[model samples]
Target chain A: MKELLNLFLTFARIGALTFGGGYAMLPILQRELVDQRKWVTEEELMDYFAIGQTTPGVIAVNTATFIGQKRKGTLGGAIATLGVVFPSIVIISIVAMFINNFADSVILQNAFAGIRVSVYVLILNAVLKLWKSAIVDKIGIIIFIAIFSLSIFTNLSPILFIVGAGLAGFIAKRQQGVVS
Target chain B: MIYLRLFYEFLQTGLFAVGGGLATLPFLYDISDRTGWFSYGQLADMIAISESTPGAIGVNMATYSGNMVAGIPGGIIATLGLITPSIVIIVIVAHFLNKFKTNEGVQGVFYGLRPASTALIAAAGFSVVLIDLVDFDLFRQTGSFIQLMNWRALFLAIVLYILANHIRATKQLHPVIFIAFAALVGIIFNFGLN
Candidate 1:
């Protein structure tokens, strides 16, 4: 029960603080979950992001659910998922009541402009860290380039890239008999 | 009732919007067309608000859109509706992955997936930086390469980047702290006024 509450509060903090949605949650999650709590490793979090992206529904919610379920079970998963969105429900409801004011607030606009740049830096650093770990080998680099290109140059969903890369890795590794 | 409709509508969206928060946009567009819940302009406005606020963009949109339709209860119902699918799907997927976690084939799959996921995020990072640092709207208007930079944001970004990555003391600071500092800087400089 205590663990569940911790999960809830931790995720609620994550949901509340991250401004730009799913991808932006990465750096924060790395800090809170990996660096602070030791709930998951950076690698496990990457795994969750991959799975979260491929699965249906919002990636941020899926990640919360994944981490929670890893810790406790269905109920833990439910609680964590709830925690992540709880802030959204409350904050959005409040903001909705005065939607016009928020929409027109120049102060909020200026703040967001800065927030956006900071978030970009955060995501860029996270991506750089991920690159060092994820793109280690020749084949890994090849897959990275292919998927990166596909992500940019095509209108296809990332789910396709994930599935294809998984299959390619499976077949490629099997042929090499490299059980890494 | 409207509550049931909100739940049902977002449930469908939660199920089918398979990638992430942004993926929900087309479905929201469809909702506007079918249910007349909000207009395209309103949807755009909702997105702007969603982007500018905290929380997942999808949840914010549902809350804002539902509130527009039916007030506070509407926000709750719509949000609950949106997240329902994530809980169900992730729990099932997590269960299987836990069981297969040690399997070699699964390990191999993740090996490739790690890089793929990194690439996906890097792509997102590129798009984000592009959006934040470039004034494409202004570029299109004047068709002048030299005038394309959002100079204030770019300067802020460079300063923040160096502090975040280069300065050892600052690098160890919490990201939220940096974000807070950035927000402060943004307000002082009126970041978007230019």
Candidate 2:
């Protein structure tokens, strides 16, 4: 019971603080869950991220559920997911009911502009750290460049890119004569 | 009845909004088209709110639409509905997660997936910088790439990067601190009001 409460608060902090989307949550998740709590390792978080991307529902919600379930079972998953979405339910409801031109507020825009830049820097650092862990050999580099290039140049959906990369890895590893 | 309808629609969205929050946009447009719960302009407003406010964009959006349609209870139901699929699906996936983790072929796929996910993140960060720090729309009028740059934003970004990465003492500073500082700077400096 105490552990469930802890999980809820942790995810609630994540949900309330996250400004942009799932991508922005990466740095926060790394800092709080990965670095501080040590609940999930960097690699596990990445795995959850990968699954979260391909799976249905919001990536953030899927990730929270995955980790929560891992921590305390079905009940944990429910609590964590509720924690994440709880803030949105409250904040957006207030805005939807009371604030008509909240988005048009210059002050809010400026603050978000600043927030966006900060988010970018945080994401950049996360990517740099991930590079060390995720990219190990030539094949990893090849996969990185392929998707990186495609993403920058095309408007194609990321699901296709990820699924294609998984297939490529599945085949390439087998052809390399070893599964290690 | 509306609440049930809200739940059903968002349940479908939860089941199909693959990739992330942004991927839900099309289904939302479709919802507006079919149900008239909200107008297209209102949907755009919701997006703007989602972008500027906290939490996941998709969740914020669900809350906004439901609140508009049927008040607070409706908002709660819609959100619950949007996330119900994930709870059911992910819990099931988690049950078999160990099997997938140990499988060699699955291992191979992840071997590829790791770097690919990293690239996806890198690519995403790159675009955020482009959109937040540069203005192509404003460039059309000025006709100069240099002028198109939001110099103040870039300067803040560089300062932040240095503070967060280069300085050992500041490197340990919490991200929320940086976020708070950025907001303070924005409010004080009047960023991007021109």
Candidate 3:
């Protein structure tokens, strides 16, 4: 029970602090789960991140479930997932209720405009950091450029791209093994 | 009935929207088209609110859309539906795939997925610039370069980018502070009024 509560509180804190999106949660997750609690090593955290990205659903939630399940079984997974999404449900519900009240206010509209621009900057910063870490090889660069162009230029579903890239990577690795 | 539909729809979204929160945008857009639960303009508003708020944007969006459809219970149901797949999948993986991390096939998938996720995020960032800073529709209608851009927004974005990158204190400050500061600037300048 204590372990379950701890998992809940720790993930709740991560959920509450994360802004922008799943990517922005990385630093906070590293600090609390890795540096402070030592729940998982840095490599394990990265593996969780990778798994989270590949899996369906929100990366943050997937990651929380993975960590929680690792720690305390299925119930722990539920608790952690609930903890992470709890803040979003509460905050968004309130905002939805009040949004129409202030929707027409010029001041609020302008304020949102500014906030939107800043949000863009925050996302760009995330992209820059991910780029440095993700684009490690020539194949990585090729995949990045290909997907980036396809995403920008076409209306293709991202699922297709992700699946195709995975298959390609798998085949390439197999070929290297055979050659070596 | 509405709650059931909401859960079912968002469950599909949860099961298919890979790569992270922003990856769900296309699915949300499809939902809006099919169900008419929310308008495109409202979808934009949801994105803004979700991006600025704490927690995953995907979760925030699910909650907002569900609440719009059927109030608080709807929100809870939809969110629960959305995450249900994740919880189930992760638990199964945890139990069955203890050695999955070191498995070459899994590693290869991740090898490809890492860059793919980065590309998706980059695409998302580019679209945000188009939506927030550059008015492509206006540009097409007016055929004027200056009229094409929300100059104030562009300027503010650049300034924030520089501050975030160069200023030590600003760099260390939480993102919420920048968001608050930008909100203040927007109100003071009456941005987007024109």
Candidate 4:
């Protein structure tokens, strides 16, 4: 029970404070979960992040669920997911009420102009970090380049690119006799 | 009828925007372009405000767009629509993650997703730069090489970019600090919307 409460409060705090969404949340998760709580090792957290990125959900929520399941099973996963989402639910509710004012506010407008640049920088750093982790082989690098070109140059939607890449991976695994 | 369309559109956005909130930008842009529900300029403003404030960028933008389209209910419905998949997926995965931890097909799908996710992020980053930083119309209308520039924003962006990269004690510098700094500059310079 204590562990479950702790999981909720900790994730709630993370959800509340974190801005700029999932990528920004990564280092914080490292500091809190890895450094302070010692809940998961750095290597494990990295693996979780890699999986978190590839999977079809929010990274923070996914991480919370992974950690929660690790700590206390399915119930814990539910609690942790709640904790992560609680902040957004509350914050967005309040913002929704006064959002028009927020949109017109001078201070916010200026702040955003600066923030826009930082967002780019943060994402660039995240890409570099993920690249170091994900692109381990010649084939991976080639796939990265091909996907990047397909996304940037052509008018193709990313979903097609993802499906095509998955087919490629499946084919490669079959050819290499790795999956069987 | 309209509400259903709105819900379905957002549902598609929620399911497929794999790289997170920013990846939803292009889809929203396309929606705006197709339906004429919102303008490109409004989308740009949404990006600006969404990036500046707190919470998930995708959710924030959805709320704003929804509010614009259908008031408070629209905002609520859209947000719910966007996050529903994440919630459902997390819950189901939590239930059975252990049995599937090392499955080869799962691993392959994840591996395939990595490059594609990167592509989505890169594409999002590119579109934002195109919309926010480059003022293509200034060149068309002014026909003057000098007036064709968004000099203030460009300068601010460059300076912020450099400072963000080089400042070694960066982790200690909260995002609010930079946000506040930018606000101060904008206030002093009166960097009003053009």
Query: Can you give the DockQ of every candidate in the order shown?
Result: 0.46, 0.46, 0.61, 0.36
| TM-score of only chain B in every candidate structure | 0.58, 0.60, 0.81, 0.81
Q: Can you write out model 1's per-residue Cα lDDT over A38-118, one digit (the tens) per residue?
A: 999999999999778766688899999999999999999999999999999988887777755676788866766667777
Please give the CA lDDT of all the candidate structures: 0.80, 0.81, 0.83, 0.69
Per-residue CA lDDT of candidate 3, range A43-112, in tens? 8899888778777889999999989988988999999999999999988888888886778888888888
How does residue B122 of candidate 2 score in lDDT? 74
For residues B58-138, what per-residue lDDT tens digits would candidate 2 score against the true structure? 899899888889999999999999999999999998888767667778778778777887787677567546766778988
- Ordering by lDDT: 3, 2, 1, 4
Task: Report the lDDT tens digits of candidate 4 across residue range A56-136.
Answer: 656666677778777887778778767876666566556656756777787666655655655555556556666776666
Supply candidate 1's per-residue lDDT for B36.
92
**Which residues of candidate 1, in runs, are more than 4 Å off?**
A1-80, A95-100, A178-180, B1-86, B89-99, B136-144
lDDT of 3 by residue, B85-173 (tens): 99988888776565876778877777787787788767756765676667789889989999888888788988999999998878977
Q: Residue-wise lDDT of candidate 2 within A1-180, one digit each (tens)?
A: 999999999999999999877878999999999999999999999989877876678989999999999999999999999999999998998888665546688887677666666766766776787789788999999999998898778766565776788899889888885635
Candidate 3 CAPRI assessment class: medium
**Per-model fnat list:** 0.80, 0.80, 0.82, 0.36
Clashing pairs in 2: none
Q: Name the candidate that leads on TM-score.
A: 3
Off by over 4 Å in 4: A1-13, A23-50, A65-83, A102-118, A152-155, A176-180, B19-27, B30-65, B95-101, B170-172
Tens digit of lDDT per residue, candidate 4, span B1-194? Answer: 76777787777776666656666765786577567888765665566556566665676777778767887667767766766666566567656655546776766666666666666666656666667667778878877777666678678766765666676765456555665666677666666564
